[model samples]
Target: MITKWEVLSLIWASGVAYTAPRILNRWSLITTCDPIELCQGCRDERRYVMQEGMTYEVMGAAGGPLQVLVEAFAWYLKPFLPALRRAAGRPPLPTCSKGSCLAHTSTRRRA
Candidate 1:
């Protein structure tokens, strides 16, 4: 049989555990800037490092694995995102269905 205090404690603990990641991630984003704008060939690398660091810190504080596999997969893809974005010329977003949108989508979707 669980006491009221234990139930309350568990609720609070779960809330903190759930909310902690969002708080930490927001803080991490606030602390870091776009690497490309700050450093040459460094944005992707820096972003990855920051992401890894942030994940490590949050997981460490949470005292449990929090989306570790997902984060790790994301980290693996981090380095390629910028390149992927740039390889197609770093085109602007599809505000309208223009050539840029089609070109970007087709290129990426191609085998």
Candidate 2:
């Protein structure tokens, strides 16, 4: 039979186990920088850093870039994205890699 102390310890251990991964993931998000020259994917990852950086630089009496307010808005639109991406004639936005923005040639959508 588990004693009260054992149950408490188990709860403590469980909480630690659960939070460790999440904390580490957040830490990675906070520190990593965009190595890909043309990739702006850093914008989202850097959001984690923005909050941790000097508050004055982010939003202070002097004023600066606003804390991201689009996270929830983007989440809400996720379900409708497929339908919204469709257009009769407009081409897809160019995709890029480390140094290349693949825009000069027509990109074909995969079947």
Candidate 3:
């Protein structure tokens, strides 16, 4: 048998336990950034680190160990995302139609 006060206390404790780490992590990131003196590389690195950290925190909070592992694996592949996007954005290979190649047709028109 559980009392209402016991349930409330458990809820409060869980909330604090979850929230304190997030707050501290955010504070650490904020304090490390020196807006005026930071270089572009430093800023980019910091941003990436912060994003990865936040991703882990959110994912860990939302699910069990397997979900956290999956999220981390996905996050590890994030750097390849831009390259994948660029490759996806490219036009399809030229196809021949009516004795004229599509690539050749476009080049001839541009000349």
The number of the candidate with the highest lDDT is 3
Query: In candidate 2, what are the lDDT values of residues 1-111, reduced to their tens digit?
Result: 999999977776666555555444533443453433214434434554556445646456433223232232233454665556664444433233323422111122211
Model 1: ten consecutive residues of lowest lDDT: 92-101
CA lDDT scores, all candidates in order: 0.48, 0.43, 0.49
Weakest ten-residue segment in model 2 by summed lDDT: 102-111
As a whole number from 0 to 100, the lDDT of residue 84 in candidate 1 is 85
Task: Rank the candidate models, highest lDDT first.
Answer: 3, 1, 2
Q: Return the TM-score for each candidate structure.
A: 0.31, 0.31, 0.32
Can you give the lDDT of residue 17 in candidate 2? Answer: 59
List clashing residue pairs in candidate 3: none
Candidate 2: residue 15 Cα off by (Å): 0.3
Could you report the Cα RMSD, in angstroms, for every candidate shown?
14.8, 12.6, 20.8
Root mean square deviation (Cα) for candidate 2: 12.6
lDDT of 1 by residue, 61-93 (tens): 553345433343343355587678788898532
Off by over 4 Å in 1: 34-111
Report clash pairs, candidate 2: none
Error of 1 at 99 (Å): 27
